[model samples]
Target: MRTQVAIIGSGPSGLLLGQLLTNAGIENIVLDRVDRNYILGRIRAGVLEQGTVGLLDEAKAGKRMHAEGIVHEGTSLAFNGTHHRIDLKELTGGKTVTIYGQTEVTHDLMDRRSETGGATIYNAKNVQPHGYEGDRPYITYEMEGIEHRIDCDFIVGCDGYHGPSRASVPENAIKTYEKIYPFGWLGVLADVPPVSDELIYANHERGFALCSMRSHTRSRYYIQCPSSDKAEEWSDDGFWDELRRRLPKEQAESLITGASIEKSIAPLRSFVAEPMRFGRLFLAGDAAHIVPPTGAKGLNLAASDVHYLFEGLREFYGEGSSAGIDDYSRRALARVWKAVRFSWSMTMLLHRFPENGEFGQKIQEAELDYLVHSRAASAALAENYVGLPF
Candidate 1:
């Protein structure tokens, strides 16, 4: 079989790209190693930058998001036993973020794709891209004990960090940078009302804790712990008690607790692979970069990547210009690096580092104090939080 473009992975990035391409009269096929149910089962961050929301609208997948997603004008930062609010909308000239889960985003895109009858092959094993260096590129995969191949004009890898796309690249052709934090986030998803109207990020003597919500009745909370920690080690009561200890008195008193629907520990890391384009095979999303999730930039970064890639592909097919494709790496990386910096900065400012000792803790608190009190600093945070322009 053959197509104009062959896409790997069925995550939000791949589905969003496929939807955009289908709407543009471009033919593309999506392949994933897992089925749709497993893809949607993965729980991820939910904060949507205005730019991301616009992309969803562009893809015609924003209706349910606009209807069910909560729009937050600002987020709160709690430190030194006090709570401070950063006016994201006011600081960013009316730009705001939407609180829609990533799972919901993927579901919407999948539905849109199915409605349009786009091609997506799931549970294909050993998928690999070949002959991307020259004009011709194709993909090979195994399905149901049969071998198959697809010939396409280009290949896109949205299959995530461990997928075959990045792994297929020669070691010398790519350079990677990574920083693994000493701690990880132990998170819980509960069907309980949020303690605050907006998300709260707390920097306390104990650790860093985040209070986020998917909706009015569903709360997602995280507390920093050692990198070696496991989810089963902490009970619901223990998690709640530790979270309350990290917040201010007012929020702690108002906080509600319940049985957790999901619980896990995610290690914090900042990683990026240089030159997202490898000949005709371009990398997007987790296949190219990763952030600590402190500033909630993971999904937003992927959306920006798809935006750049879609525009490039559109130009190639619509105008017959190679400029966009040629510049995809440079363009995507420029924005990727900025987000990496913002996420790294937020991680440094909010999380407690035991290795840094008392001096580091004091410095972190001092920076947080200055960040909240200074309008310029606060605006900078708000701008990054709402997302940089695409």
Candidate 2:
């Protein structure tokens, strides 16, 4: 097979990139190791930055999102038994975030691809990219007990952290930085009305808890737990009990409890691989970096990476220029590092560190206190929350 670009992985990044390129009259094919249903089954963060929404619109996949996604002008931060609201729109000059599940975004993109007859080969086995450094790059994969090869101009690795894309890079050529938090988030999805119209992030003596929702009637909640904790360790009632204790009395009182529809524990980490580009092969999304979910930057960062890569490719194909492609790594990393910093700061400000002890706790309290009282600090938070400019 021959194509202009060969994308590995069918997650949001790969699918979104494919859709965007295809809509622009570019020929591309997506290869994934898993089937379509398995890809859609994974539950992920829902908060959408305005930049991400625009990318989906460019891909013609924003119809369902704009119709069903909830818009939040601001988010609330709770500490010291009080909740303070940060005005996202006011601080960011009319910018706001959309509360739409990542699953729905994937579904929309998948449907659009299907309608347009885009090429996506699912259950592709042993996918590997070869000769990415040369003028011609190609991918090989196994399917239905047969090996196949695809010749392409470029290869994009949207295959995520564990996928073959990053693994294909020589170890010495990449420099990596990572920090694993001492705690993990135990999250639950329930079919009950959210306690608050807007998302609430609480920093209490117990731990950090977040009150988020998929929609008006569906709530997604999370509480910090030990890194070793497992989902089965807590019952529905127990999870609710811990979560309520972490919030202000009023918000807790208004909370509605129900059996959890989905529950899992996700460890927090901040990671980045330097130089996202390796010759003709480029890494996007989870294949390149990971941020703690504290600031809701995971999916947003991926969208930004896609934005950069898409623009670079579009420029190369449209204008016969290599400037954008040549500068892709430096530009993408600049934004990626900022987000990494923001997420790390948020995690430090809100989470309890057993290692930090009394002194650390006092510092966190003082910082949060200043953040609410000072307009400058609040504005900074709001700006990062709404997302930095693409």
Candidate 3:
């Protein structure tokens, strides 16, 4: 098979990119190692930066999102037994974030692709990109016990951190930076009303906890735990009790407890791979970088990466220009690094570091105090939270 672009992975990045390319009259096919159901089963972060929402609109997948997604003008930060609100819209000139599940985004993209009759091959095993260093690169994969090859002009690796896309790059050609936090987030999805109208991020002596919601009745909550902790070890009552202890008394009192629909522990980490472009093969989303979920930058960063790659490809195909494609890595990395910094800073400011001792805790307290008291600090937090410029 021959196409203009061969995309790997069927996650939001790959689907979004495929949709954009198809809309531009660019022929592309997506290949994923897993089936459609498996892809949508994974739960992920849901906060949407305005830039991400615009991209979804461009992809023609925004109908349900705009209808169901909750708009948050601001977020509350709870520390020292007080809840402080940061006005994201006011601080960022009318900018706000949308609370929509990532699963829903994937479903919408899948529906759009199916309606448009786009090509997406699932259960494609052992997928590999070859000859990307020179022109005429192609992808190879195994399906139903048969090997197949796809000749394409370019290859996009949205296959994520462990996927073949990044593994295809020569080890020496890439530089990696990573930091694993000492703690992980024990998250729960429950069918109960959220405690607050807006998301609440609490920094307490116990740990860090966040109160987020997918809708008015579907709530998602997380509390920091040791990296060694497991979700099964905590019962629903225990999780709720611990979570309440981490928040202010008033916010905790208003909280409603229920049986959890989903529960898991996710380790926190910050990682980035340099030079997202490897000849004709380019990496986007988790394939190139990962940020701690503190500032909710994971999906937003992926959207920005997709935006940069799409622009480059669009310019190349539409204007017969290679400038955008050639500059993709530099531009994407510039924004990626900023998000990495912001997520890292937020993680440091909110989470209690057991190893950091009393001195570190005091420093965190001072930082949070200054952040709520100083307009400049508050605005900076709001800007990063709503998302930095695309």
Candidate 4:
């Protein structure tokens, strides 16, 4: 098979990229090692930046999102036994974030792609990109013990951190930077009304806790835990009790408890691989970088990468110029590093570090105090939260 572009991984990044390319009349094929149901089964955070919403709209996958997603004008920061709201819209000139689950986003994009008859090969085994360094690039995979090959003008690796896309790059040709946090997030999803209308990010003497929701009736909550903690160890009642202990007096008093529908523990880490493009092969989303979920930047960063990649491909095809593709790595990395910094800062500010001792605790308190009171600091947070210009 021959195509203009061959996409590795069918996650949101690859699916979104495929949709955009299809809309542009570009022929591309998506290859994934897993089936669609497996992809949908993976639970992820929702919080969509305004720019992400626009991309979904451009891909014709925002209908369900705009209809069902809740719009939050601001989010709250809790510390010192009280809540302080940061008006994201006011701070970012009418910008706001949409509370939608990443699962829903993927579902919408998948449906849109299916309706348009886009080519996506699921359960493709041993998928590999070859000859990316030269003018001719192609992908090889196996289906039901039958080998297949796809010749393409370019290859895009949206296959994520552990996928073959990044593994294919020679170690000497790529440099990676990573930091693993001392704690992980023990999260629960329950069908209960949220304690607050907007999300609350709390800093307590014990640890950090976040109050988020998938919808008005489905709440998603998380609390910092030891790096070795396991989800099965915590009971539903225990999780709720601990969460309440971390919040302010009023929110804790009104907080509703229920049986958890889903539970998991996710470790926090920040990782980035430099030079996203290698010859005719390019990396996007988790294939290139990862951020702790503290600032809710994971999915948003992936969308941004897709935005840059799509624009580059579009320019190359529409104008017959290689400038955009040539500059893709530099442009994507600039915004990526900013987000990595923001996520890292937020993680350091909220999480409890026993090793840092009392001095670290005091510094965090002072920074949070200044952030909530100072307009400039609040504006900066709001700007990054709503997302920077694409």
Q: Judged by lDDT, which candidate is best?
A: 4
lDDT of candidates 1 onward, in order: 0.96, 0.94, 0.95, 0.96
Candidate 1 wrong stretches, greater than 4 Å? none
Which residue segments of model 3 deviate by more than 4 Å?
Answer: none
> How do all models score by TM-score?
0.99, 0.99, 0.99, 0.99
lDDT of 3: 0.95
Tens digit of per-residue lDDT, candidate 4, span 217-332? 99999999998988999999999999999999999999999999999999999999999999999999999999999999999999999999899999999999999899999999
lDDT string, candidate 2, 48-143, tens digits: 999999999999999999999999999999998999999999988999999999999999999999999899999999999999989999999999
Q: How close is candidate 1 to the true structure, as a TM-score?
A: 0.99
User: What is the descending lDDT order?
Assistant: 4, 1, 3, 2
**List of clashing residue pairs for candidate 2:** none
**RMSD to the hidden true structure, all candidates:** 0.6, 0.7, 0.7, 0.6
- Superposed Cα deviation of residue 12, candidate 2 (Å): 0.9
Q: Which stretches of candidate 2 lie over 4 Å from their true place?
A: none
> Where's the lowest-lDDT run of ten residues in candidate 3?
381-390
Clash totals for all candidate models: 0, 0, 0, 0
Q: Write the per-residue lDDT of candidate 1 for residues 122-225, one digit (tens) a residue.
A: 99999999999898999999999899999999999999999999988999999999999999999999999999989999999899999999999999999999
Model 2 CA lDDT for position 141: 98
